[model samples]
Target: MTIVAEPQFHVLAVDDSIIDRKLIERLLKTSSFQVTTVDSGSKALEFLGLVEQEEEEQQQQQTSSTSGLSSYHQEIEVNLVITDYCMPGMTGYDLLKKIKESSSLKNIPVIIMSSENAPSRISRCLEEGADEFLLKPVKLSDMKKLRPHILKGKCKDQQKQHQKITCSIDITAAPSPTLVAGSASKRKSMEDDTLAPQRTRARFSSETLTVII
Candidate 1:
């Protein structure tokens, strides 16, 4: 009789702020992900290299372990990367680019989280190949909304492959014009810092997670 072990899914979170790192770690811990965090992009890159080396060694030792030759098959393999956009030396964008360009690490999904809400900044990050984006002050609801998609292992290449559907429909038919206008007005009001107290609470419903930032 033989017993087969399930492979563990590993996640790497990179952030410069200790508090933010801790928060993300806690959030991921609450979820099903096994997360490892680093304080710098450079360190994250080094850690990625180490993971690859360890994976190579593991592949060589897999047969040995199955034959009861050694007890060294407990290493975890990283499958995802979460990073902050703003960092000291190598920015998250730069790090993402490096990872996407590398053959060994290109398959890993990279999620970018940042406080900057500039549309241009978010657009640039997405254009540069970020898997997903999360705003700062992350809430539990937002994390839940992102988890399913992240866990699905969908990368930029996969998204591009699915972008051919070009059907447009009038949204007015689905919702009342008054309601739409009111929602738009409320969103505009929330953009003003003076209406900080009137900010709408984050809402979560059972829906497919496919949000881009």
Candidate 2:
């Protein structure tokens, strides 16, 4: 049997301090996560493909003016976002709100870190949908909280995908009264109904299912 290597989870770490950014990057790498560090929450948003319309328009203009220039955003999946709570311009709480507000990116987990142990700040971050709040000078022990949030996000994504698959199967199998379709539609629907389960089974083998469960 050929052993398949597990894909590494990607993390986006946002911090204004260069020292803190390096430290967090090192800690995340040591924990076996693929890390991408950004200096500000705005930069983090850009990395995650959540750029504002004005900036997007500017990038488009720049790309048009420059030959062979391409502006690509977020080519990889970011499993988690760990940001410093006190960044200039866009704070971590602001970043969390932006993530939570977005339909496509809201499901990704976010963690907030700060040097101050203010109760109100912690509560506010958690209330605003931050998965965890870590104190500054984050330790390896604090890294343990990261995995659970990533796994939770993964599970949620899988559940949504499964639901979509099930819905597709149901729609193809069920007969619609209002629709006036020919044999070709019926045949395709039958094919979909027949093949959906097999495709799902192939995608999630016994071992994969076991691991997920």
Candidate 3:
């Protein structure tokens, strides 16, 4: 029997702060996720194997052009993208919007981390399709919330397998030929009893018969 290997989830971490990048890297590695840390959104997109500015440029030139840029990121599939909300050149929100707009990359989950606890900012991130918003200096506990979203994909795959198995069992669990035939025979017998001609009792003429009179 071949042993199936479990997939290791890879995460992309983006931050302009060097210290925070190191911290996030260590925490993610400790949690057993394959981690890649980048200094900016441009590098993060580069790590994802996306062509810089070209994808956006192409989209602007041709509204419906689907495929032109090559993704180096496809080699190691990234299950999640976690980025700092505030960066110098391109902000996390900008990156999130780019990822979401990309037809090829939009499915990846994006989590935003910010030092600011502004409710309006958080609401904006959520509205922009950020999966989770984490307060800056993320903790191990916050990492726990990250797993469920990645595992959701696995759960859906398992559910599909379960449905297939259930359908097979239902098909196999059907009544046997003998049992089916017996039921059919019983039904026919009942139908014959209900529809068969009934015999009536013959009535004798008491005093009205000529011979008797």
Candidate 4:
């Protein structure tokens, strides 16, 4: 029998401190994740193939003659982003906002790490769409929390695809005319049943994030 190894998850780690960057890289590697470390949040955006639209427009106005055409293409699919909350130029909160605001990158999981255990800041980050917030000096145990979030992201994408497929099948595989006429009320009930879970999920997501710090 041939055995194949599972593909490693790719993570983008952003921090201003070289020591912390090295530490995170080492930890993630030891946890069997493929890690890319950047020294700044802006660089993280660039690595993710994103730029503020306003900044790009300003650059175009200032240097249109000197520069060629621009592209906002993502070169890699990063499963997760782990960033330090405090940085020189763009704080991790700002980076988190950028990622969540982007249509293409919004689905990727983002984790914020801070040395300070500020509840208000944690609440703000969670409200801003951070998947997980970790207090500084992240441990191997914290690394375990990461896999669930990543798998959740993947499951969301799969659910969307499944929904699409189900919709298509329902449209094409219509019930027999006799059955449709006789079971109209039953069909309505089934439709209601199908939609109820979706509404429940929406409500469940609105619930506050559990603080892991």
Q: How does each model score on TM-score?
A: 0.57, 0.67, 0.63, 0.66
Q: For model 2, how does the per-residue alpha-carbon lDDT over 76-144 read when each residue is reduced to its tens digit?
A: 778899999997899999999998987667888999999999999999999999999999889975876
What is candidate 3's lDDT per residue for 1-213, written digit by digit as tens? 111123457889999999999999987765557888899998887776555565666543443212222333445667789999999999999999988777656667899999999999999989988989999879865876676666554344346446442222122233421111111332343334323444111111111111110
Best by lDDT: 2
Per-residue lDDT for 153 in model 4?
78
lDDT of each: 0.59, 0.69, 0.65, 0.68
Best by TM-score: 2
Query: Candidates 1 and 2: which is better by lDDT?
Result: 2
Model 1 Cα lDDT, one tens digit per residue, 1-213: 211122334678999999999998877654435779999988887676523434555544442321111134334456678899999998999889888766545667788889988899888888877878889977544554443444344334345457542211212122322111112333242224223443222211111121212
Stretches of candidate 3 above 4 Å error? 1-4, 52-73, 153-213
Candidate 1 lDDT score at position 86? 92
Residue-pair clash count for candidate 3: 2
How would the candidate models be sorted by lDDT, starting from the highest? 2, 4, 3, 1
Please identify which of the two predictions, 3 or 4, would achieve the higher lDDT against the true structure.
4
Q: Which ten residues in a row have the lowest lDDT in candidate 3?
A: 204-213
Q: Is candidate 3 or candidate 4 better by TM-score?
A: 4
lDDT at 180 for candidate 4?
Answer: 14
Candidate 4 wrongly placed segments (more than 4 Å): 1-5, 54-73, 163-213
